[model samples]
Target: NTTPTAVADAGDATEKGGVANGSGGVVASGNVLTNDTDPDAGDTKTVTAIKFGATSGTLGSALAGTYGSLVLNASGAYSYAVNETNAAVQALRLSTNTLSEVFSYTMRDTAGATATANLTVTIHGANDAPVLAVQTTTQNATVGSAFSFVVPTTTFTDVDSGETLAYAATAADGTALPAWLSFNATTRTFSGTPTAGGTYGVKVTATDLGGLAANETFNIAVSVPGNTTPTAVADAGDATEKGGVANGSGGAVASGNVLTNDTDPDSGDTKTVTAVVFGATSGTLGSALAGTYGSLVLNASGAYSYAVNETNAAVQALRLSTNTLSEVFSYTMRDTAGATATANLTVTIHGANDAP
Candidate 1:
């Protein structure tokens, strides 16, 4: 057997061999196998490995038995054993599934040569589900407000390696969650805007691919602040209509207070008042405002008007105008929230006894 000799930095040097994840095996040899023959005789000498040993560097301590440490015998076969559930095993598995080591060997020829190379092994580990514990038992959120809280990873722990976790939130009592609150299962987070105020019972569950699961319950209380109902401004009765001399020009006129009486429950809320009705429910007041003798007209503020005498010239000349004009109407008050209140209005116009 023809053995190739190794040349170190200054010439003679040694190599160190290491265990491959305790599986017990030589990953690489210091020299490559080769064949040489005497020119005239045509005799060939091939590579023959003679010695294998740990020239330097100590193997890691064996966890249980000889898991992490490596063992190489003279024949070149190596061996090792590791517990699947060992913490070191889990750490190595999590870090890229590989362990680094070095080993040395000598060839079987006249010049024994040795070199060292890296040995790496991919480690297999058991998978497991994450375990969870509740860090917060109660939470508070403002009503009608958006909220988000990240579930801390420290709250959960996993014994087995290589696990990704998922989270889900539900009502402990099995009641459907309010439309406001929502959960992000992928991020293992809880988030949502609360619409109403109330004490809600909820449970958060964490699960892993290994089908391991844990749950924790907490009360989420939504605080509801006192709300005020809109104020419907009371209108002081309209001005008293003065009694005129039968059908005379000085007849008293009246109008409902439109803008002055409108109000909102919230001080900052917008409110609007509109005269929903101009005259009686059964009849149209006239073609337009003030068209009929007693036609009623509405202002932007909800104030209304009626003409005492809309009769023709001849009727006025004969003093035969409407003696009394009466009108009934409705007004609607609205707030920013679309809430509405309606009111009725009645007004009678007195005349001096001639009919138009």
Candidate 2:
């Protein structure tokens, strides 16, 4: 009843005609019959159980012949293994209880009928979460501007294509999404114009059909537009001061805010003073007083103040001596780009306040 076939190739292996390759080490046998049977032999048959990557075992019962288990390990998909005892079968003890491995069996009838076959069994692991390319990104927008952020198709990826993946967005603090923004779970995007200028932080989570999840956070900065270049009121303004009097105690001193006096159209714009210089003077005392009559300078509110002494002889000599006094000065305001805006600051001094 002994049935023999062509010799098995010990080089290349397949499931039926060769041993399929595996990750964890596994003991496989030669390719033969899936289930062998013999006519004259009784229904009784022997099965050779070769544990390729077993954790622990007595190394008993898995008999191919009286010699030993015919489990020969080689680096080939197709290979032949003969029955022999003490073949030094290696058992790489993997740490986990779940892994995929192959088990080969050789069944022989009592009448000497024999066949070999193998099957793969995988000890599955817990489902895995998809991975994202970026956990955070920052984008800029202006108030009232159309704003939108869409997650790229490649934002989340899973090795298992069989598992369906979904996306959800929420506030990073787990409270709620930004007031001005809305999240689309299907598109994985954030949309809506920002109501005001500020920073909005959001978190997005990706979940697989298996319930495995991963998340990422994003930062968005919204600003008021036209702030890059601020505009202020007229670049020019005037201030006057009476001459401090040496004649009987009559003098003129005046103060004014140069900035508030001007206009600033840019809602979020601010003006700053960069430089102040007096120009050529004219009029009766203009030459003698010139830059002296008044000063051009910046105040706390980005404005200027002018003054004069009608009583002081020097001040009076400049104006009262000639019946009139005049002087001119120049100043520069800082633009949004740190540039400068030049303008004139005029001051007039009269002899009216001079001592009789």
Candidate 3:
């Protein structure tokens, strides 16, 4: 049998022109055998196998690629679909502005004789739109401190090769930022000291040279100045010591609101517990602190609980003495206007008879 001489043709594909205003990918399809031919008498052509670089395999129809998928029909027709998010492809496109994949296909004759030939597909680049990393952001500030936020350059991206982005900020309603706030297009930052109290919204836009743009919104709430210090009242509570000697097992818990009688001179101002410090140690939010004689758990809403350790030798000695003991804790509270107050809480433990 005479071996069929298989000739292959080159193909072209574009990495651009897909979804999201061409920020995605596209498909390239053509007949790879369009310029190929078999020099055998009465021989019919058939695609039997495919090979890419060092790898060789049977190709009844399709093969996958690093940046896309490739399919080859028996008739020699082929299609290559590019993956837009492929990092390698993006890097190549950005560096050299071009990409390509080359592979060889084996053609068989009706008589079973075959030959192989190569084909290459070149991918061209094009402009794509910029996309926002985050669509919206929220922030809070008080009048006493200057407010500032910088929009990261990486916040907006253009998948197309080596593209730069420009930024701008405005009111969400397409107006100017409030007088108290100023936006710097060059720095991609919002800065200024707020002079009033209210919720404000600003829209930020990132645009590429191709006129394609992406937008993000910032919702900022600034507090009014002239804050009045809030009062943190000294609180008191009582607990009965359990009649046991085991650590953490025989303890009595005392619960109360440390801010029950606290007040803020500013009208309509609300205060919340911000921190609790016992001596030189401080407790984390939503967590408990181990005190000298027990453990104290405090919440942001001013509610607190103290567990008295009946196993403490000093606490057990109280039963023989005055039959009582006292523990004090310090906590801080902040009002809506930013004023803060610190106070103490005293918890009394009454000794009870043990069942020795």
Candidate 4:
């Protein structure tokens, strides 16, 4: 076989490897080939021969003469024209009939034209709910004291979307609530003063943008005060009698004689007297030495007493002589052995009852 050679006067080679004539290889009528439409002068007139046959045994055999010159269809599909000039083997894959064709096409070439298959995509819902976290100043407190705490602003969140949340707090027993209590919405904080004394149950619930909720509960206790009293004692030893009065005579009287006597000077408003009496001793009228008066009313000053006033009647008689006289009367006397001994008396002689 002889190979075709370019003539010395040929202008250029066509895409089919043919020498370019003056008008680019004779316009390629029927069996003629040309590169009149090629954008570059180096393009040749060499045709890309394609044969439609199964490349592997998995597909059926191909028809004889099913080889041809390659031509791109109007819809961008490829077609081969009949040709027997130079036979060649080529693989042809059928277009997929399922939705997987688009995937396959996309995987192979992302920039490829859209396929005619219908596609559906599914999306799943998020699997997260709101969460609640709690905090407080103290778990225990005394009555009428302050109990404070804070609920974090970010207490609840949607795990998938990360949206802001809302929340509120409630006391188990409304009657036992704190005296001064309030809540802040912006900061989600709680503060209050507990006026009552007892254990309180507190609960908080948080809600997310999706309306999902969560909650937490806790306890607080308050204590009460104690009791108080007083005590006293008396001093009985502080009360005592000072002393008794003494006789006015220069000599100590051996027998019961009329003498001035007084109660203890230090005696208070209330007084208690304790005494031992001697036996009776008296002297008759004008008698002097041996015996002394049995009884005497020497003086009566402040709440005084006389033995003659007693019902026993130990004295023989009672007498009062002067108003200002210190010794008013003298009666029978008593000995130490309690026997009547003597009587002493002084009788005044009046001149016909001197009335002046």
Identify the leading candidate in terms of TM-score.
3
After best superposition, candidate 1 residue 44: deviation in angstroms?
40
Residue-level error in angstroms, candidate 2, position 327: 64
What clash pairs does model 3 have?
none
| RMSD of candidate 4 to true structure, Å | 57.3
lDDT agreement with native, every candidate: 0.45, 0.47, 0.72, 0.29
Residue 89 displacement in candidate 1 (angstroms): 2.8
Tens digits of per-residue lDDT, candidate 4, 47-90, equal 22222232111111222322223332222222222221221211
Better of 2 and 4 by lDDT: 2
Q: Summarize candidate 2's per-residue lDDT along 134-179 as a digit string, tens digits.
A: 4343456678888888888776765542557788888866878877
- In TM-score terms, candidate 3 sits at 0.58
RMSD to truth, every model: 31.8, 30.4, 14.7, 57.3
Per-model TM against the reference: 0.33, 0.37, 0.58, 0.28
Q: For candidate 1, lDDT tens digit of each residue in 248-316?
A: 443444555555666655766555543244432322222234423345555545566555443533223
Sort by TM-score, best first: what order? 3, 2, 1, 4
Off by over 4 Å in 4: 1-128, 133-138, 153-157, 173-179, 224-356
Name the TM-score of candidate 1. Answer: 0.33
Error of 2 at 257 (Å): 39
Model 3 agreement with the true structure over 1-356: per-residue lDDT tens digits: 77767676676666653236345555778776666566667878878777787766555545766666678888877888777667556544332377788888887888888788887777666566677664343456667579998887777776766677888889977998888899889998789988766557678888886677878664675656666666778998877677644332354688988888999878888877766766646566468787877778899898888887766876766553248888788877776755566789888887765645
How well does candidate 1 score on lDDT at residue 66? Answer: 21
Q: After superposition, how far is residue 73 of candidate 4 from its true place, in Å?
A: 33
- Highest lDDT scorer: 3
Ranking by lDDT: 3, 2, 1, 4
Model 2, position 259: C-alpha lDDT score: 52
